[model samples]
Target: MVSTGITPSGIFHIGHIREILTGDMLTRAALDAGMEVEMIFIIDTADPLRKVYDFLAPEFENYIGHPIGAIPAPDGAGKPSEGGNYGEHFLSPFVEA
Candidate 1:
C-alpha cells in the first residue's frame, strides 16, 4: 500500500485539500483505469511543528490534539477560521462553481 500524509502544519489550507482528497481522488481514478493502486491516508500528528497550527487559528487552538484537522468549527458553521468552517469561507466560490 502506498501511504501519503497531509501534514497539518500552520496554514495548511489549499495544500491540505490537494494532498488528502485531491491526491486520493487521482489515485482512485487511476485504479479504476486499470493501474495498480493503493492509497493510505496518514494524519501526521506527530510533528512538533504542528503544535503551531493552533497559533495560526487561535480561535480553534483549544481543540488541539484529538483529530484536529476534523475539528468542527466552534459554531457549526461550514468553514474554518482563525476566528469560521470551510464552506462559510468558500461559500462564494462554491456557489459560483
Candidate 2:
C-alpha cells in the first residue's frame, strides 16, 4: 500500500524522524507477520495551491531539487540532511528504499 504525508511540520522536525521510525517499525512488524509492504514519502513542498500562488523564498524560489534534510530547514535546527544538493534530498530516500 502507499502512504503519503505532506510534512506540514516544516523540513526540520522530530516529526520527520518519528514518521520514518514509525514506517520502519511497522514495515518490520509486517515482515515478521508475513506481509509484503511498500512505503513512499513525498515532500509535498511543491503543491501550487498550498503555495497560495506565492513561493517561500530559499524554499520555493531557490531550493528546488534539495532534499528536506539539506535545505535551510523550516527552523534551522541543524543541517538536518546528509545530502549535498537539492536533487539528492528529493530522490535519495526512495532510491535506497
Candidate 3:
C-alpha cells in the first residue's frame, strides 16, 4: 500500500502538490509493474490549530490546541464563520482541483 498524509492546518501549497504527486507516481509505477498497490490519502483534520496566523483574526487564539475540524472556518474578515469547519474549508478547494 502507498500512503500519503496532509494536515489541514492552512492553505494547500506547492509542497502539498509535491507530496501527493510523489505518492501517485509511485502507485502508478507499481501498478504498471503488475504489483497490487493501494493508495491512501489521509487528511489530518483532528490535528490541533497551533496558533493564529497573520491572516487569521485574533479571536482564533481561542482555538489554539483545538482540533481544526472542530473549529469554524474563517470568514472574509478573518473572523470565525459558521459556514464550515476549518479543515474542510481549506481542503475542499484542493480536492475539487
lDDT of all the models against the reference?
Answer: 0.50, 0.47, 0.94
TM-score of 3: 0.89
Task: List runs of model 3 lying over 4 Å from the truth.
Answer: none
Look at candidate 1 and tell me the lDDT of residue 67: 49
* Tens digits of per-residue lDDT for model 2, 47-97: 322231122343444444443344543223223333353324434454475
The number of clashing residue pairs in each candidate reads 10, 4, 0
TM-score result, candidate 1: 0.42
- Who is ahead in lDDT, 1 or 3? 3
Candidate 2 or 1, higher TM-score: 2
Ranking by lDDT: 3, 1, 2
Query: Which of the two, 1 or 2, has more lDDT?
Result: 1
Candidate 1 displacement at residue 71 in angstroms: 17
Between candidates 1 and 3, the TM-score winner: 3
Flag regions of model 1 displaced more than 4 Å. Answer: 50-97
- Residue 66 CA displacement from its true place in model 2, Å: 18
When summed lDDT is taken over every stretch of 10 residues in candidate 2, the lowest stretch is 47-56
For each of the candidates, the C-alpha root-mean-square deviation to the true structure, in angstroms, is 7.4, 8.1, 1.3
Ranking by TM-score: 3, 2, 1
